[model samples]
Target: MNFTDNLAIQLKAAGFSATTDQLSQFTTYYEMLIETNKYLNLTAITDPHEVAVKHFVDSLTALDDKDLIFKEGAKLLDLGTGAGFPGIPLAIMRPDLEIVLSDSL
Candidate 1:
């Protein structure tokens, strides 16, 4: 099974529903990471399973409290967000939340 399929199974098992657009973003995100890693050292997660489990799964785990995360007009700041660990994924999952990814490079 592909990473997207495995991610779906894992999310469902975690009692969350991942839409096709989310899956597509996950796939595209992984693909872009892989492509960019050729020139830059972005993430240590190279394997699909590892990326899904460590990166994606870990990111989605924070969504357990959907109500608190998506409060009306919530502002989140990710400080020193190198590659945006929880920030980017959180943004993707909850577009309603405002996010400011801050980094120094």
Candidate 2:
């Protein structure tokens, strides 16, 4: 399976779901990440399954708290988010939330 398929399976295993648009966005995001890594080295984990499990799925794990931490339309700042980790995935999952991603580099 490809990146998107792997990502979908990973998300499902993590008890999460993604819309087609979100999946498309994630696919584009992964493509951009891989392409950018060719020069800037955005991430050390480049393998597709590794990225799906370590990066995307790992970031998305925060969504386990659907009612407590993630208030509707809540604004969040993801400090030290290398390659837009939790922030980007959270933004993709919860469009109602306003998320900001930041890193030292």
Candidate 3:
């Protein structure tokens, strides 16, 4: 299965739902991350599955508390957001909320 399909499956298993378009965003994000890593040294985890689980899934853990994470117009700030980590994925998952990704480097 492709990255989107695999990500969808994993999201479903985690009690989260992602539409095809949302999954496509994740796929695009993943591709960009990997591509940028070639010169920027963004992330050490390059394997697709590792990125899916370690980066993507781990980031979604913040959504376990829907009350806090999904609050209308909520703003989330991910400090030191290397590779966009939880910020990017959270933004994709909860478009309603505002996410700010900041890094010192």
Candidate 4:
């Protein structure tokens, strides 16, 4: 299976059911991240499976609660969201949230 399939499996294993569009977005994000990292040194963990588990799945782990920590339509700020960590993933998971990603650079 390809990286996308691996990502979907990992997400499912973590109890996340990402929509097709969300998966597409994540795939796009992953592609861009890898492409950019070639020049910008975005991340050290570049292996596909590692990125899937360590980055994407790990980001969504915070939402395991049945009652989400943030209220609907809440504005969230991902401080120091380097290369869009939990922020981007959270936004993808909860479209109702208004997330702002920030980084020093």
Highest lDDT: give the candidate number. 4
lDDT of 3: 0.88
Q: Tell me the tens digit of each residue's lDDT in model 2 across 14-95.
A: 9998988999999999999999999997899999999888988898777896665888988899999878998898899899
Q: How much is 24 displaced in model 4, in angstroms?
A: 0.5
Tell me the deviation in Å of residue 27 in model 1.
Answer: 0.8
Q: Per-residue lDDT of 19-95 in model 1, one digit per residue for the tens? A: 89988888898888889888988888889888877887787776787665557558888898776777887777777
Clashes of 1: 0
Please give each candidate's TM-score.
0.87, 0.92, 0.92, 0.93
| lDDT per model vs. reference | 0.81, 0.89, 0.88, 0.91
lDDT of 4 by residue, 23-45 (tens): 98888889988999999988999
Q: Give the true-structure RMSD of model 1.
A: 1.9
Clash number for each model: 0, 0, 0, 0
Which portions of model 1 miss their true places by more than 4 Å?
65-69
User: For residues 1-105, could you state the per-residue lDDT of candidate 3 as single tens digits?
Assistant: 778788888888888888888899999999999999999999899888888888998899989976654687888899999899999999998899888999998
Off by over 4 Å in 2: 66-68
Q: How far in Å is the alpha carbon of 46 misplaced in model 1?
A: 1.1
